[model samples]
Target: MLNALLFDLDGTLTDTDALHLLALQQLLQEEEGRVFSEAEFTTHVSGQANANMCRYLFPERSLVHHEAFAERKEQRFRQLSPQLQPMPGLLRLLDFAQEHGIAVCVVTNAPRANAEHMLRVLGLSQRFACVLVAEELPRAKPDPLPYLSGLECLGARADEALAFEDSVPGLTAAVGAGICTFGLSTSQPPQTLLDAGAHRVIEDFNDPQLWAEIHRRLDVR
Candidate 1:
């Protein structure tokens, strides 16, 4: 039987990818006089941790530089948190899960502060049973550690859990953990997400396919 739902934070629960892109554009341009386009942002920045992104984008820069840029970028993101919007039908899904006695967990590669800010902004700070931060783990997304930890926390088996993500890394992590991963088409394109190992691509929580799967999973109980 289906036992739990694990979700990604940033692009999955709320619509904040645009804010991240804007922050990146302004910061990158002001700090390095480089033009950061949407395509580049989606490819290199989305689904990645701050330090990892900085290292990948600026390998020559010192650790201090990476830390500073990550701090500044995160501060800017918090400033834009007030504009965050929860995914449509998200409340309905949560209510359904609660009524069905299914566990829910949030698994993300976002920094702790950023994750807290986003959940608070969405008024979902107290919703989940557990919040797993990839940064707090020895290995981040694409390593399966975080998602596996989430399942362990919820006492749910991989075959009994459903994971939702909007980025390649998050989806890869969940799928690698042996969970059925659904990709949200919010930041990355659908095909891009599928190529990363997502079993299904959904527009949002309101997606018909998502609801169908929800029913199929719970009806067995």
Candidate 2:
């Protein structure tokens, strides 16, 4: 049986991707005089660190400058936290999971401070059994370190968990960690997510048919 559910935070549980994009755009523009289209911006930092993103956007900028730019973006993200909205059906799902005695954790590649700030604003800091921050690992998504670390903290095994994510990198990380992966359409198309290794993909969290399928999987495991 699946004993736990691990979730990706930004695009999975909350609607903060737009805010994150805005912050990154502002930082890149002010520091490097460059404008990135939505596709360009997302493709650049899809699953990369701030420093790497900076280098990719402004190769001429010093590492120190890039670091400062990243800090500024984070500061702006903190300011925007109060506006963080939980994804549809999130509360219901969480409540159902808890009632069913399934442990839930937020496992993300976001910095610890950013993660805490967002969760606090969404009143979700205490909802999760564990919050695994990316900084805690030497590597993040697409590497399995974050999810593996989360499983360790939850005292759970791969077969005993299900992972919820919305992006290709997140799905890949969870699948690589040996967990069953469920993809959300909040960030990508259903086909894209499934192509990235999601066992199944849903258009919305509130879909009764999808939840039925998820429950079936959980029950059978």
Candidate 3:
């Protein structure tokens, strides 16, 4: 039986990817005189940890500089939070989880500020049992530590939890931790997510097939 629902915050729970992309594009232009294309953002920036993204995008910069850049980028993102929208069926899924007594946890590669801001904007600040930010963990997404930690925090085994993700790194983390993972398809192609080990790909929580799979999993349990 699924005892917990582990979710990725930015793109999975809320449609913040486009906002983030814009922030990154603006940041890159201001800081490095570079332009960040949407395809590049999807392929390189989305789903990556702040530190990793910084290193990848500005290898010549010092760690301190990268940290500052990340902070600025996130600040820009938060400024655009007013435009945030919850992923379709998010509230219904939360209600279902609540009615069924399933624990809901937010597991994200996002910084704590961004995570908190997004949740608050979606009016979901108090809905989750726990919110695990990657920076606070020993390792971030694509490493599985964050997802493993979320499962441990919920006192749920990987087999007893379902994870929702919207990026390759997030999928890798959740799947690596042994959780049944679903891709949100908000940030990457469905095939990319499937190749990254997602059990299924969904446009949002409203996908009937997602509910069907959930019912099937529950029936077996």
lDDT of each: 0.90, 0.81, 0.91
Ranking by TM-score: 3, 1, 2
Off by over 4 Å in 1: none
Worst 10 residues of 1 by lDDT: 212-221
After superposing candidate 3 on the true structure, give the runs of residues whose Cα lies further than 4 Å from its correct spot.
Answer: none
lDDT of 2 by residue, 131-153 (tens): 98876779878779999988988
Model 2 residue runs over 4 Å out of place are 59-62, 218-221
Which residue pairs come into collision in candidate 3? none
Q: List clash counts for every candidate, in order.
A: 0, 1, 0
* Number of the candidate with higher lDDT, 1 or 3: 3
Indicate whether candidate 2 or candidate 3 has the larger TM-score. 3
Write candidate 1's Cα lDDT for 87-152 as tens digits. 987898898889889999999988889988888878999999989988899999988999999999
The residue pairs in collision within model 2 are 1-221
Clashes in model 1: which pairs?
Answer: none
- What is residue 41's positional error in candidate 2, in angstroms? 2.0
The number of the candidate with the highest lDDT is: 3
